[model samples]
Target: MTTQQDPSRETVDRWAFADTVESGSPARKPGVRLGPAIGAAAAAALVVVAATVIPQIRKDPLGAARGTVPQTPTGAPAAQAPAGQAPVGQESLAPQQTPQGGGGSLTYANHAIVGPGGACCSTSGGAWTAAGTGGYPAYTGPVRTSADRNAWYEWNLGRPASGARWDQIKIRLWIPQAQAGAWVRITVTSTAGSASNVATFDVAEQEYQGWYELPATFTIGTPDRRTGSAWVKLTYLRPYTDQAAAQACADGSCDRMAAAQAEFLWS
Candidate 1:
């Protein structure tokens, strides 16, 4: 029992502006802060003292009950690691978990820019296309303009080849070096209505330049909404030009907008 509060933890938190603390419960420690939730009275109860020091803080001169500690090399509040303290901040980050064969996952054959065909650029209309380019085993197309039809596809997740519905459709894709910073929208249409999920890549993240399952598991349609509908169609919206597709062949940095080995994920 000491009269002094921890110098580092003696902070007046402003209405719980405390996102910096990591997960896992922090136990009551002498210097460690229990946070603002604990009122001043509760916090005051957590002090420790050397054997010779008096338990009463008022009786002790200066609140040095914890003893004279060395100053931090910098004046900033530094993290003090007490003996056997497990390191903080082991966050359970968003998962890009690989789909194992049996875990609520189903396979849906991709309709747009299917893979393992090899890299080549073509044009169906004003929209530029890359069926198989660079042997990357995925689609990589960048929009030559902000047009709606530049890079687009409509694939149906037909009434469950295996069952009536599934957890979600898993689309496997790879973001190549050239495909960095590409924006795309995925829209799913079913009996109820259409829902659109959009995402963009600014850097080569976890699955960048390599085959990776899209971070999100998408719903073709909900059970009620899916009843009358025959199947769910997923459309990719991106704009590109034929000229741009040819240019991509010349340039090594190609923006891949295609996916490979699409499947329905089941529970």
Candidate 2:
């Protein structure tokens, strides 16, 4: 015999079938999550969006390569976070920089030259005196008395490549036999534009004799810093003897007995 189904029972069976299809079968279990596929698709879309946007947000390499970092329209680094913190590609600039001064000691030697100029006058030229052979011009005229004494010679050394710093100077002088025992004086006066700067030294009467070597050391009176030429003058302050001995070249031109030698070292 055929039986008729109840409406409520049919409806409940269809609902149960749909729930199983949507969730899971009774023999099996559901997964830990149901949205991983959607999540992965969303992540891929995000990557595409970043790829399209990052280039626009990044700094221009051309400007950075030229050392002129690209800036925002507001005159700040385009990527600066906020504080003085450097932008993305500038980690190497953290260290800072500063300048540096001079040193070392300098040394020099002393040298001298004599008879650089030719000799003039003969023994018979004047009062007539005899200067030994090796001596240039023979001594002539009366002995140099206190009234007739002058002891300086001046010359030009031209432009100096390395001018003298004047730490120390050694002067070697030669006086006539008649002038021996007289006070030998040496004065160094600046002949450059500033002539008033002068240095003076007196060889005592006791020290005055034939062939004397005087080493006078002095600090250079401030540097003149004058680039051009300068003159050096040496003068004798006092005359040695009071009487006029025969045939003395101390007064007149004496290539023989009167001469001066000097040596110096500078920094």
Candidate 3:
């Protein structure tokens, strides 16, 4: 009993004696205290951790609380049109072009010799001859006479493009000054039996000698597919006079009544 008590009491007495002797005062509690350098280093480390974690939490508070990264929403791409095709609601609405010419106009040369209603005119006596050396290749017809007071010249303009709407019709002609009071009537007819209004051109009103343009409003139907053509008829309607009869045979030449070309203008 003496031996066991002595051993335990000796251990406790030795720790108390050493603390009291080293400090030369009452023994202090056994604990650790931080030095100035270590305390500052620990405080800086805590500041660095707070700075890094606080920004992350501020940027995405819910994500930081949930411990997950935030996700962004993505949108689908837009639709595109096929190659060589127009986009929807952006299709072109321009009028179709003609084969003869472009720029909203169609030109045709007058070369046929047949008149309207299959009526034949005498071409043996040079009544209808090419107006050679007259700038444009035109055909000259004899002046209207008592016997042949009405001469209808026809031009077979080929079929216009489908749905073509011509606003103006033009004819190029040459009328001599001697036929001052003579007149010509222009009309358009299709093989589909559609006809336009009569357009009259009077020499007395125009006073044109060499080349002149006769324009008219075109409001009739377009060319038909039946014959694939439109007929432009120029009727020379003038009462024969003694002066016209004398001037017709002057110098063995008929008065120059020529038609060169015809045109259809688009709106």
Candidate 2 TM-score, true structure as reference: 0.32
After superposition of all CA atoms, the RMSD between model 3 and the true structure is 35.3
Q: What are the per-residue Cα lDDT tens digits for candidate 1 across 1-267?
A: 111111223634333233676699878877765667776657556443343356555565664444555355685444655655533333233435794443232444333333233232222223433433422444343322212335443334344433423335454444444433233443433232454443332222212455545454454454212332212222234333344545643442233344322233433
Leading candidate by lDDT: 3
RMSD in order of candidates: 20.9, 34.2, 35.3
What is the TM-score of each predicted model, taking all chains together?
0.31, 0.32, 0.33
Model 3 per-residue lDDT tens digits across residues 20-84 = 34546777889889999999999999999999898887887763455443343553333455776
Which window of ten consecutive residues has the lowest lDDT sum in model 2?
120-129
Clashes of 2: 1
Residue 231 Cα positional deviation in candidate 1, in Å, after optimal superposition: 8.7
Pairing residues by index, what is the TM-score of model 3?
0.33
Q: Candidate 3: list runs displaced more than 4 Å.
A: 1-127, 135-150, 160-183, 188-196, 204-206, 220-230, 239-256
Better of 1 and 3 by lDDT: 3
